[model samples]
Every structure is written in structure tokens, then in C-alpha cells.
Target: MIRAALTSNVQVKVLPGPSAVTTALLLSGLPTDRFCFEGFPPRTKGARSNWFKDLATEERTIIFFEAPHRITESLEDAQTAFGSDRDAAVCREMSKHYEEVVRGSISELIDWAKSKDILGEITVVVEGFNPGTRQFSVEDLVKLVIKQEEAGESRKEAIAQVAKANKVSKRVVFDAMVAHKSGDKI
Candidate 1:
């Protein structure tokens, strides 16, 4: 019946699936230079929210695969956890049929999704932290470590936070801090 309608010149469209989503993600200006796709965070309210929270500060761009039925809810959850103003994109039914891409702040997309009953697969592209937005510097790290030492984080614990946040090795952070104090190049 559907094919017969199309044979009579009826218009039809196809939606792209995971493959198109992946390719679009690869091309998205975010930072596929290095990134990861955590397809669909948990569906449960509590677990899903926590997962979003965990990824809130991730410096790398993230691509998510979402079902149409859940897209609005997922976008809302992402806005709440990653900050409403967070940069993001939603591409649905990519290459084949009924393709649509909405790129904007998380809140903007959330509002857009809520206004319509979405259909087809969706891939969300979100911008990562802009370069040089990091609040801490080498000096700041040292100062924080000093404070942590006084409060309770072992030298090791303080160093770990520095490494985790900076995406460097603990030894690198330690050596740099020590060299800075001693007036030597690290």
C-alpha cells in the first residue's frame, strides 16, 4: 500500500540510523580529534541523572544516541545536569529520510523537542569546554594542594585530583609544582 502510493508520485523520506549518526558526530566541529560516544545513559530516573552529572564536566564533546520517544526527556535531563546553556546539537534520521538537525544550547533544544512530537533516531552533538577556560593554573594547583594537605587529602590524593582534572600524570603535576617552587624549568 505504501509503495503503491509512492509509485503514484507520493513523497516519502527515510531516516538515517546509527551509521549516519556516527558519521555526523565524526564531522561535528566539536572535538572528534579525541572523543567518546556513551550511547543512551540509563533510562531510570536516578541512575540516568547521576550518569549525566558524571559527564557534566567532561572536556571532550559527547555524542549520544537517543530514541525518538525518549529524546525530549533525555534532552531535558542533559540540560539540567550539563547546564541549560551548554552547547549541543540534535540530528535525527540523518541521511536517508526525514533528517533534521537542531544545534543550539541544551535549553534551546529541550524547548524545541518539547514543542513537537519527535520521530526517528537522534544523535546529539555537544560542545566541549572551550580552550583556556580552566579555572586553575600551575600556581593554583600548588595552592590547592597546600590547602588539601592541611585539611586532609594526602599528597597523593591532591596530586590525583590535579592529574584527573588536567588530564596529565600525577608525576607531571608534581614535578612541575616542585620545579616551579625551586626556580627550575620543568
Candidate 2:
């Protein structure tokens, strides 16, 4: 039946897990210049948590592929790792028989995911954290400043460079690096 339907309509779009995510991301009006497509993380709790932890500092939109059986757990993991307030979209069985789209904060999505018997492939699109508001560790700030300086930039110039590269405030970088060098916390 599925193959027959495909044969009848060449223009028909089969929005599977990843493709549905791509489409949703494209329509999100978010920056598409750079993005990461993360298919399903490990099914087990430990590995999955670790996997999500790795993505905590990612600065680009992320896509996930999940099975219906695990949508609730996945959403829960996303909330725990990325924070409950993080904005995201959950697309399930897209372009197919049981298509559904859910969008909201990670916490809300986790609640929604738990209340139903989700069917088919699931695609999740999550917003990246705003770089300006994020507080990097002093060590990291120092490293960034040093990297820019090594690129032939002065302290002032390096602070500016780090700020612009990370979309944060120049003062933030400067203060962090200065505090690090002085053994003080900003």
C-alpha cells in the first residue's frame, strides 16, 4: 500500500524522521546557516544522558530521530539535559499515515509525549542557547581570549574577537579573562 501510494504521486513528500526534522527546521525561521542532525542517541539511560550532555553547549539548531516507543523518554532526557524551558519541536510520523507535530518548551513536550501512544518516526528540532547570555567557565573564556590573541590580536582586540565569535559581549570576555588571570571569579 505504501509503495503503491508513492508510485501514484511523484511529488508526494515522504517526510520520515530526519527529513521531517529538516523540513520543520527550514520552516522555523531560525538560522539555517549551520545546524547539526543528531539521529537517535543511545537507548539506555546512562549513554543517552551522556550523549545529551555533550550537546548542552551546542550553538546550533539540533535535529533528533526517535522511535514512537521512546518519544516520552527522549523528551524527558531533552528536558533534563537541555533544560525544561528550552524551545523545541517534536514531529512524529511526518508525511505518512499518522503524522503529528508538537511544539513547545521541552517540559511541555515531555508531558505531551507521556500522555499518548506516539506512533511512527519522531523528529525533534531544538533551539540553540543564545550565546550572549551564556556564562562560559573562566578557563574557557581565557582559552578563547588566548586563541584570539595568538591570531595576532592584542588583548583588547582578542576580547572583541572572542565576543563576536561567540555572539557574547566583549566586556564579558574581557572580564572573564581578566578575572582568570587575576585568580578572581567574574
Candidate 3:
């Protein structure tokens, strides 16, 4: 094999333009201060389903790039994982002449995706997990920790994950863990 080293001293710069990720996030009407960009979901159905499940506890808003053809399937899985009423937005062909945006609950988006033959670049924005929007009891929180632990996470890691996901303090999760283990009221 012949080895050749090539280097170029070139500085190239251009005006930053709007990207599909940020633009869709902004169009979603969700919080932008803390957000995460998930470039694209898994192509296979099983992997994509698991991927969505893993993001169930994410506290930051999520942005996903999706193809128009798979939008309906992805939306279905999203609805199953994030629940029917989770706030989300579907942006199609953003910034183009035929650009369209639909913002609503996951259920509504699912309906929209299934209603017609979608064509164009698609971006999906989902609101972050908000504990306030849904109530969880001590038992529920404890159960979540246990589930996380069962999913190959350490006890401590599971507790922390549960705390963050539920928007509760570590102490709360620890107390719940102790109460649960000792069969005492929390």
C-alpha cells in the first residue's frame, strides 16, 4: 500500500441558514431552551419501537427526522409510547413553497398522517417528558425504578433515572425505594 499524506490550509465560511431540525422545533411551539436532536429513528420497526421506549424518560424536547412514507408508522409508534395526548408537531417540506405544519396531540397527528399520501421531508417534534402533566404515586415511581433496574441498569442508576424522568428528587426516589423494600408506607 502506498501512503500519501495530504493537507490543505483552507478556511471556508458561509452564512448559517435555517436547518430542518431547529426550524421544526420552533414550529412545534414547544420549549426550545432545552432540546435534543435525534437525527433519525431506526428503520426497522422493532428497533424503532425500542428506541422510542428508551426516550420515554427524556426531559428535553426531542426532534426526529422522518421520511414521508414512514411518517404514519412512526407516528403510530410514537402515539403508543408517548401516549395519545402528548403534544407534538409534524412539519413537512419546511421552508419550501408547499411547506406544511400540523401541531396537536400525538393522536391527532397520527390521524393526519394516515389521512393522506404524504410526500416531502418530514420533521417531528415532541414535547419533553413533563411530570406535572401526569401524576405518579409513590408506588408508580417505585415500580418505574424496578422496571429500569430489570432492564439492566444498576440500582443507583435506576433510581436516578426514575428521579429525573419523573421530575422528582433523588431523595424522593430513595425514600420510595426504602419504603418499598421494607414494606413500609411512603
Instruction: Give the winner by lDDT: 1 or 3.
Output: 3
Candidate 1, residues 1-186: lDDT per residue as tens digits? 433544465543433345755565643434566666888878887777767856766878888888888888888888765667777878776774466767678899988998999888778888775535544456656865675577688888978875775556687779767877897764
Query: Which candidate's lDDT is highest?
Result: 3
Instruction: Give candidate 3 misplaced runs (Cα > 4 Å).
Output: 1-16, 136-186
Highest TM-score scorer: 3
| Whole-model lDDT, model 1 | 0.70
Rank list by TM-score: 3, 2, 1
How would you order the candidates by lDDT, starting with the best? 3, 2, 1
Task: Report the C-alpha displacement of residue 148, candidate 2, in angstroms.
Answer: 28
lDDT of 2 by residue, 96-161 (tens): 666666767889988888887777767788888665566567777688688667769899988886
Pairwise TM-score winner, candidates 1 and 3: 3
Q: What are the per-residue Cα lDDT tens digits for candidate 3 across 44-159?
A: 99889878977876879999999988998898988766778888889888777777878789999989988999999998999988766766567877888888888899999999
* Cα lDDT, model 2, residue 105: 86
For candidate 1, the TM-score is 0.60
Q: How much lDDT does candidate 3 score?
A: 0.81
Candidates in order have lDDT scores of 0.70, 0.73, 0.81
